[model samples]
Every structure is written in C-alpha cells, then in structure tokens.
Target chain A: MSDAAAGPLATVTLRVDAAEIDAFAETLGMPASPVPPTFPIRFLFHPEIRAALAMFLPADGSLPIHVGQRFRYHRPLTAGETLTCAVSATPPGGARPFALVRLDVSDGTGAAVCQAESEIAIAAPGFTWDKLK
Target chain B: MNPPRPGEKLAAVPIGPLDGAAIERYARASGDDNPVHLDPAAAGAIGLPDRIAHGMLVMGRLSRLALGWRSDAVLEAFECRFTRPVPAGAALTGDGRVAKVDALADGHRVILRLLARDADGAIAAMGEATLRLPG
Candidate 1:
C-alpha cells in the first residue's frame, strides 16, 4: 500500500484561463475576478486518480463523497498563469475506504504556489482495495 | 465586520443557490466530474436524495471571504470539516469571524472561524483559517 501510495499518481500542467475562472466565479454568484481561491484544484485532476476511484465507484461513477479539504497557499493564484501539480494519493487506515490526495502546485517559474489536500470517503462496502493496489 | 476583534461576527454573505448549472460548471472548471454531482439518477442509485454539491464548493466561499480581507494578505493555512452534505440548489450563506489575532515578527496572523449553512440554518461545514497580513 505504501509503495503504491509513494509515487505520484499523476502530473499535469494547466494554464489558468480567464474563461475557466469566470465559470468558477459564476457558480459562487460572484463576478469575475483574477481567479477564484479554490481554482487550483483544477490541476489535480487526472485519469489515474479517476481510474483509482472508479474501482469503488457506484454503478454511475459518481464519487467517494468529499469529506474534508484544506489548502496552504504561498500566493493567490490568478488567471492566465501557468501552473503544474504533482499529485499523490494515500488511503488512511480504516475498514471504510477513504483516501486523501495532495497536490503540490508550482508556477511556470517553478516556484511553489500551494498544496491542496482533499479527503474523500467511500460508502462502498465489501469491495477489496487489495484488487486495486 | 467589526474591528477584527476576536469573536466578532462578520456580516453573512449569501453564497449559493447552488443549482445544477453551477455544480456542473464547477465540476468542469475544477475537473471533478464525479457523476454524483451531475447525475441525479446516479446519486439516487447510491441512496442520495439527489445530486450533491461538492464540499469544497462550500469551503471555497470561505476562501473568498478570507482573501477579501486584504488584497496583500495570503492564506497561510485553511482547514475545514464537512459537517453535512449540501444539496444542489440549497440557499446557502457564508459566515465567519475573527477567531484570534497574533503579532508575528513579519506580520499579523489573524485566525478566522468559518461556516457555511444550508437553508434550514444548520451548519453544513465549519472550520478555521489563518491569514497573514502585512504589519
């Protein structure tokens, strides 16, 4: 489990787009700004993480519900800035299948921007994570 | 909005009428297309009454409030507990206050307490953030 969790599950670079930022702001009923505070989570998404969660997904592939989330930002991320993130997933000890993902984001200049952690709790019972690992 | 005193209550800002459109837009922008957020049928299949909005969406409102405190400030730490599920289309509000204030060598560390409440006025999520502002 440790070995599987040690290596990064994915890496993706994204140029923050004004439109995407606008879309996010629209959801919160806020007018467009440089960037929304939670916008950094965009870089954390990847196929591998999706596939991992798919192992325990409900028939419709909805989710493991998001239980908690946290972030530490070095600076405010703004629109049009390019950033990359390396993501790692770790399942904490428990019978219930739940996991935490950490995304370490860096700007185009390679300076650290922020670290976002998301905790997801799965309601899947009787599924063996050993198969996925 | 009081003078940043500990335990001072800030005016509540109405957050979401978090509908399907908003949920889908957030999913697309954040790249988190967990079907439960987009597909009501899928959500019901899993026993949810309907597609649930993302927990981070609630917390994001708090983040916005914290950043609005000072344009020059940075969020040094932010942590939140998802107390309950916020359904899509719920009229939610963002509420928070100053929890503590400390003088650091480089800046003033203001601790903030945050809450997002669903329409029933029950707390859906709660947490605290520490923001560092210039001295």
Candidate 2:
C-alpha cells in the first residue's frame, strides 16, 4: 500500500515560441528570445511551466490551493524549444504531498538546456471547493 | 539620499488587489489559462478554495522592485519558493534585502533576496534576483 501510495510520476511535454517567451521577458526587460549565453534558459520558461504543472495537479477545486513549497531549475529555455516536463510524487506523508518535477528543454539538435523541480503540497480535505467559480 | 547600494535594504513594495481581470489578461497573453489560475470553479472542483494568482505575476512585480534600485540593472538570475497562496483582491507587499554585490567587467551587479508578503505579513512567494548595475 505504501508503494502504491507513492504514485507514479506524471510527465508532460510542451513547445514554446519566442513571442510568448518574449511577452514575459519584456516584463524583465529582456529580448523575447534571449541571446545564447546571456541568461540561463531555465529562467526563461520555468515560471510558466511551473504554473501549468501546478494546475495539472488535482486539489479538489478549492479557493486556496497551495502546491509549491520549493522549486529548483537550472538551465535556459530558448525560443522554438520543446520541453519534456516530468512530475512524480515522493511517498506522501503527514498532511502534505512532496514531489519533484523535471523539465528538459531541448533544441532541434536534441541538446538539453533546462532542468527543474518543484516541491508542492495540497492541504488535506475539509475546504470548500465549490464556491470559487 | 542615493538609493541603498544593490546589497543594501530597499523599500518594501506592497502586493495585491489581485485583480482577477489582470490575471485573466495574463492568461490570455501567455496562452496558459490553467484552471487553477483562471477558473475559480475549476480550482474549487479540484479542492482549491479560491483563485490563486500566477506565480510569475508575483515575480514580475518583485523584479520591478529590484530594478527600481538602479536604472541600468539587468536581471541576471531569479529563483523563488512559492510559500503561500495570494488570494485574489487581497493586498500584498514586496520585501527584500541585498544579498551581495559583484564587480563584473561590463558592470557592477547586486543580488537581492526578495519575498512577497500578504497583509498579515505572511510570505506569499520568496526568491532571489540578481541585477547588473552601471559602473
């Protein structure tokens, strides 16, 4: 049962464009697609991916779902890059769930750039998930 | 007085009034309407109590605070731990203390360790940001 409780990791892959990355980069005052060696590629796309992966997790549809406790990603995401994101739960314990997610962003040549992990939690039941809409 | 050096303490910037519309706009702009960030109903159905703000939005605002320290500052590295949820329409604040200042061939740089707090002073998001300064 403990082994079963340690659910298998979930994996997802996404393709990102320069324009989309640029929009977020603009807020940071950087080019839409950062120049190679300018800034790490993980920073370029991890935020969005983090948010997306957070949503992918089920939380009973409640108002205050807090999933990420800690996140670590090292590498840069380039425009026209495709990232294969993987998430898995570490054995669940004591009122929270701990997991690690890795995002592999690669170019056409299959050269990898960014790898990231997020530590997330979903409060145990007893919250209202029906009123938020 | 000249603004505190990059590594020095800077003023705290408040967060919140987490407008749902703004979040929607960010979703539309980013093309990521993850139910948790966009649909309150979806968030609830999944057990989330309310609509939560996008983590990047909080980071963007905090980065603004860091840039305010120096005109030529360029973000070098930004990392954070999402500590708490920032419910929509609540007031939030940004706090930071400079971690280090570096001298580079192109310019001087400062690293600011920052955190966004709710009105109750609870951390909503915490992270570090590095910026390049004009020599």
DockQ of each: 0.43, 0.15
lDDT of 2 by residue, A1-104 (tens): 02234433454566765665665554334445433222232332355545544544455442334344232224445566665654444433565344434344
Worst 10 residues of 2 chain A by lDDT: A35-44
Candidates in order, TM-scores: namely 0.83, 0.60
lDDT of 1 by residue, B2-90 (tens): 23568867677777888888788788867888777888886776566788888777777767777676667667889887766677888
For model 1, residues A1-133, the per-residue Cα lDDT tens digits are 2224444766777777888778777766566675666777666565655554354334533347777778888887877888887877776556634577789899989999999887776644332323222
lDDT (C-alpha) at residue B67 in model 1: 66
User: Root-mean-square deviation of each candidate, in angstroms?
Assistant: 4.7, 6.7
Query: What ranges in model 1 sit over 4 Å off?
Result: A1-6, A46-62, A94-97, A125-133, B1-3, B70-72
- Docking model 2 quality class: incorrect
RMSD of candidate 1 to the truth, in angstroms, is 4.7
Residue B25 error, candidate 2, Å: 2.3
True-structure lDDT of candidate 2 = 0.56
- Deviation in Å, model 1, residue A30 alpha carbon: 3.1
Count of clashing residue pairs in every prediction: 2, 33
